[model samples]
Target: MVSPLFITTFTLLFVFHLNHTSTVRPKMHINIYMYINMCSSNILTNDCLPPLNDENDFLPPLNDENDFLPPLNDEIDFLPPLNDENDFIPPLNDENDYKKFAIKIPEKWKKKEWIKWMKQTEEDWLVFNTYIIKKKKKWLARKEIKWKNWIRGMEKKWMHYNPHIYREFKSNTMKKSQSWDDTQWARWIETEGKDFMEIEWEKWIYQNNKYINEWIMNQWLQWKNKKIMQWLMNSWKCEEDEYWETWERSTIWEKWFNLRKRRKWLRWHNRINKETDQWNKWVKSKEVIYTKEANNKLLEWINEKRNSFNNWKKSFIDKWIHKKQWIVWIREKQNLPCTI
Candidate 1:
């Protein structure tokens, strides 16, 4: 019951609408692509993006929904603009500037904060060091001038206070030289040339004998003891010849000779007493107080004398002197019989 004209018109309008959408869809896609390309290419221009209804509406989607945005504290928000001259971060190319900023860092910062600050400032420090190295010669020249001025001032003050410093310095140098002569050089000479030194000393003593005698007499007058002089003379004589005849004739030798004569007489008397005891049959022997060491020494000496006498006896027999004359000579010399 619908009119034919109305149905035809409705169908034609729907076909036309489909064809227009198909043709325009591709053009719209192409326009969007061109717009994105233009925006990327002119990103720094003011007209890069169409104005948005809200600035936050066009933000890219983030991976985490709760990620923190920048702090909006008044201190940060009200900071001078980045391009402002007053807020400009000066290049830390000067050493003083680097030290100033470095000293400003707090000592109590956490490790992560310290690391972050070091990473941020490392480039500036390197740049400042390079600048210093490039100007090193000029800096050193200035330092040298300052050092010379300070030295000159010190010298002037020293001269005002003590004008004898140079003389004292020279004296110290002489003392050092004298010390070397006294210690190291003297030691070297003593060690390396000892025989040469001994010969020189002998020559000196021979040359200076008159003076040395005078000095000895003066020393003896001061000491006033003949024993010391005797000891010195004995020592000198011993050094010349230890077994000299004069040394054998000393007082000690005389005392030893007398002791030996008494010992021999005692022995002969004891022998005579023993012979009489054999006849009388009851005479007791005398006791001598000899220490163990003295007895051992006496025995050794007696053995030595007995061996010598035996050697002489053999010689006498070979020479045909083992007669009555030899027996009488032995009795006179030792007071003992030659035979048993």
Candidate 2:
């Protein structure tokens, strides 16, 4: 026979193992499944005992169809749908909908405190203000004509009170207005004839009354705009060709300037040509003189220094013979005449 303490210890060990682990179908010798079914049935109805299925998030199958539990997949609220059309999901609050749609309400719903000052009159507000001011002034004037007349006389005396203010107000309101330029005169003359009397001029002008005039103005405006743009582009700080105008070159009197510069340049060229001809004659004469003088000097030098002078003069003469006299003459005369 097994010892009683050993049997008790073995039973306690098995119970602890079943409580702590999964797959705890009691592996006893007989009627194992019957015991499990009875235990499950007892566990469901027992309120004091916490659910074993609660840990695994399991709920019992519901028998009733109209239960509040959410439907699977395409889940919707079950109680009631609150839209005129089934297609719309109704926003619960009407005020929220009004704000969402940006609806404007009447003046009665207006929120401005200052609106209390706006009086309700029989006439439209715009018209009524004018009548009210006129009526007030007329009634005040009739009741006190002497006072009004006195105030009118005082207007002259009031100028001394604030002379600058009156002067400024008068200057601002009373302006010397300028008439517009005669646009018809300014627009390019339409016909070969100057007057409006020519048959072709009249016909052409009549044919192109409104439409063509606008087109011409647009073209002129475009041309002027382009010219201004080009001038701006080709200014000193720019990188394009310029549109220099008569006004822009106001400092330059072109017709007189062109004539002046032409006369000056021609005069200088004439002087220079005379100088160049004279220079050439002088150079040729010097060449002969130099040849003679150089030969005489070479002979005298040779006589003085003998063979040493011959050596130096030979190199000098060689260099002189090769030298371009014209080029040298121009370089000296014009100071950097060569393009290079």
Per-structure clash totals for the candidates: 0, 0
Query: Can you write out model 1's per-residue Cα lDDT over 146-264, one digit (the tens) per residue?
Result: 53464355334322223343463332322232335334433432343233323433453344334433443444344324422443243222332233233345676553655533332
Candidate 1: residue 99 Cα off by (Å):
35
Clashing pairs in 2: none
Once fitted onto the true fold, the runs of candidate 2 whose alpha carbons sit more than 4 angstroms away are 1-257, 300-340
TM-score of each: 0.14, 0.13
**Clash count in backbone of candidate 2:** 0
Alpha carbon lDDT at 81, candidate 1: 44
Off by over 4 Å in 1: 1-121, 133-137, 161-340
Please give the CA lDDT of all the candidate structures. 0.38, 0.34
- Stretch of 10 with least lDDT, candidate 1: 282-291
